[model samples]
Target: MTLNVANCQRCGKVYLKNMYGMCGNCIKEIDLQYDKCLKYLREFRSCSITELSEATGVSHQLITKFIREGRISIKGNPNMTYDCEVCGTAIRENTMCEPCRSKLAKETNQMHEDENRKKLREAQENHNTFKIQDRLKDRF
Candidate 1:
């Protein structure tokens, strides 16, 4: 039987394909980094995201991913505020700030409304064109 395999996204080494898509070595390294970050957080309790990254030797992006994935939580630590993904504003929870999120929501709704209007107009135009048979001409 053939086996599933893929190159690790991090180190580019061939590995058995898994859900995470990373090789075992890279996964272990990330796990270690996570442990270090958790330990530091437990001890410090109030470090910013930059500080956590510096202490744990992990990238800010990975830490943000961990927070987004619910692996890291900032609820108890007020100093762990990170920048909003959409804007540079500092945010307490989630990636995007409230304003950015609301703006995106509004834009999405407007797009959907426009699409619906276009569809309705197209349907009306199609329905307006009808084939009328000339019964008198047919008889002639």
Candidate 2:
């Protein structure tokens, strides 16, 4: 197995890095916090993100991360609002709001279309350019 080593963001300890950018100890701590938050939610049911974080001592960012991961949902409970990554607009399900997602999709499509057009133009130019020597028969 390949070892990817890095420093833990929470404890500042040197260790093999994982996807969360934190070491195992910190990850466990976060898991415990997630459990705490979940328990609190089950009891409070209607608590807002602020209240949840305040009660559980978990950071707002972590709770948002959990929401983004689809572990926690705010469907009917309007109190829990996941914000848009770009504009911080309250979103329900996804990481981004609908408007932001649409805008991003359009921009991405436009960039790809522009790139393809440039390539096609270059290809046409290369194929259309003719040298006078080509019109004449070879000496052989």
User: Each candidate's TM vs. the true structure?
Assistant: 0.85, 0.77
Q: Which lDDT tens digits does candidate 2 get at residues 13-79?
A: 9888779899899999989999998899888888999999999999999999888787777774668
Write candidate 1's Cα lDDT for 1-140 as tens digits: 98899999999999999999999999999998888888999999889999999888899988887888888889988898778988889888877999999999999999999999999999988885534565556766
TM-score of 1: 0.85
Q: At residue 5, what lDDT does model 1 achieve?
A: 96
Clashing pairs in 1: none
**Candidate 1 to native Cα RMSD, angstroms:** 4.3
Which regions in candidate 2 have their CA more than 4 angstroms from the true location? 1-5, 16-21, 128-140
- Candidate 2: what lDDT? 0.87
| Top candidate by lDDT | 1
Worst 10 residues of 2 by lDDT: 131-140
Worst 10 residues of 1 by lDDT: 128-137
